[model samples]
Target: MTFYVCIKRVGDILLSLTAIFILSPVLLVSALLLLCTGEHLVLYRQRRVGKNYRPFNIYKFVTMRSDSEKSGTITAKNDPRVLPVGRVLRKTKINELPQLFNILFGHMSVVGPRPLVRSEVDMYPEDLRQIVYADNQPGLTGMGSLFFRNEDDLLAATGKEPATAYREDIMPIKGALEAWYRDHKGFVVDCKIVVLTAWAVLHPGSAPVIESFRNAPGFPEKELTDYRTLLARTE
Candidate 1:
């Protein structure tokens, strides 16, 4: 392995294990809460395209009914399928904590492109598929993930069918952003992405700040700026 990959793998193992240990209590409580509140699984696992276009089960704390995606793949704002506890988990991104296990198992990296389902993968334009998916492991957080952190809200605002909006409007942007990260992948870049992701989670209203951090070549600057305006109005 190259020096970067060697160091990154080491860091991933250390950080992921530490996080799982520290967050075990939260994980347990969330699991208990899910069991007490409804008839749903505490953890949700679904197949997502990973590095080399390999398939792996991505895990997350359950945020919706077992068959919620049967109705639709995208979750819009005020999506009724999300349980009350789920809303808190989703908004706080606590729902993603279970992916720490995926990281430990080498199915993911702490910082890389966010994995997409097979359907989403199938829609990736040819160039993006070769650049972003063929050679990189999907991440817990990365450029595309942080840029579209408010994905459900974006979809809700479109007034188009959720899947339609995602395919036409959101997916292309995500593809570009992921492609950018693939080019810029490095220890320093991953650190910055992780820090920005934490900042976005804590300050969901800071669109301008988030947008500033995303200034990179090949990104659709105009679209991000427009989305920032939309986010500002919502705030």
Candidate 2:
């Protein structure tokens, strides 16, 4: 295996195992809460396109009604389908923790382009497809994931149909960002992205001024400045 692939697999295994071990208690508590709130299902699995254009069931902690997608696939701000406990899980990203199992099972990576559904991947422009379809496993988090962390809010703010807004505005931007990550793939970049994700969650106002975001076509300008002023305090 190449150096990048070797380190990535090793890191994914070691880190995922360690995280699962350390967070066992948290996972247990979350599972119990999900059962109580969701009545039965604890894990939510959805088909996502992964490396080599293969499809796999991506797992997350159940946060919405089992049939919630009947209304729409895209979640909105204050989405009613979300259980009260699920809301907290989604906000804190505890819902995403189950993907550690994905990494361990070699279905995903610790960091890479976040996977999308078949409908979304089918919409990728040729230039974007070349990058995403290359030999890279989808990630638990990535550049697009971090940038679009508050995407539901943006959709709600615009009052646009969620799917239409995503197809016309959001998907294209996400494709470009994911393509950027593909071009810039490296160990250092992966580590930086993971750290930046945590930072973004804590400081939603401050988007990381990465090349991808700086060059993203049609990225919202006002959204960019949401937390730029906070830089003074950090510096």
Candidate 3:
């Protein structure tokens, strides 16, 4: 690995360990709550496309019914599969805390493209598929996750079938965002993305995070316009 890559890996290990330590209480409570209610599952693991197109199990807290995938993998706004406690977890992003372990284990980074499921990966723009994750490990949070923070609601607002909207409209923009991150990947950029992710979680719908990257090369203009138009319809 290059010096930057080594440093990033080290940072991921240290930050993930620190986060797990600091958030142990929240993690414990979330786990206990899940185990006691909502189909009684704590952690949910599913295969996701990783660096170099490898498949690995990505971890998260169970925020939906055990049989949720049978209906569809694309979760919609007010999805019926979501449990009562799940809404809290998903809303506050506590459900994703288990992924700190994934970071610590070197399966992911602190900031990179958010990992996608096999089906979603297949939907990526054909040109972007090979290079999106070629150098960077999938992340717990990144540009795609940040900009599409309200993806469930956006999908609902599209008024098209969830899979169709995602395949046709969402993935193209998400793919471009991931490519942008790849082009700008570095220590400072990663730090900015990490802070922006936290900001998005704490202040959902308050502002557009994409504005923060107004000068970024390869900014997805048409996709973003379509995204905002759909978002406006939601309100």
Per-residue accuracy of model 2 over 1-235 as CA lDDT, tens digit each: 7988998999999999999999999999999887776656799899999998899999999999888978867787888899888899998889999999999999999898888888777666656765774787999998668777777766665557777767666666677767767777888778878888878777764346443356545544443454232223333
Which pairs of residues have clashing backbones in candidate 2?
Answer: 205-227
Q: Candidate 2 vs. truth: CA RMSD? A: 4.8
lDDT string, candidate 3, 1-235, tens digits: 7899999999999999999999999999999999999899999999998988888999999999988889978887888899999999988889989999999988999898989888788889899888789877999999888888888887888888889999887888888888888988888889888888878777777255767777666777877777677778779
Against the true structure, candidate 3 reaches a TM-score of 0.95
Best by lDDT: 3
Local error of candidate 1 at 224, Å? 3.7
Let me know the TM-score candidate 2 reaches against the reference structure.
0.86
Cα deviation at 94, candidate 2, in Å, is 0.5
Which is superior by lDDT, 1 or 3? 3
Displacement of the residue 67 alpha carbon in candidate 2, Å = 1.0
By lDDT, rank the candidates, best first.
3, 1, 2
lDDT of 1 at 51: 95
Worst 10 residues of 2 by lDDT: 226-235
TM-score of each: 0.91, 0.86, 0.95
Per-residue lDDT of candidate 1, residues 27-93 (tens digit): 9999999888866569899999899989999999888888798886678888889888999999889
Q: Which candidate is the best by TM-score?
A: 3
Name the TM-score of candidate 1: 0.91
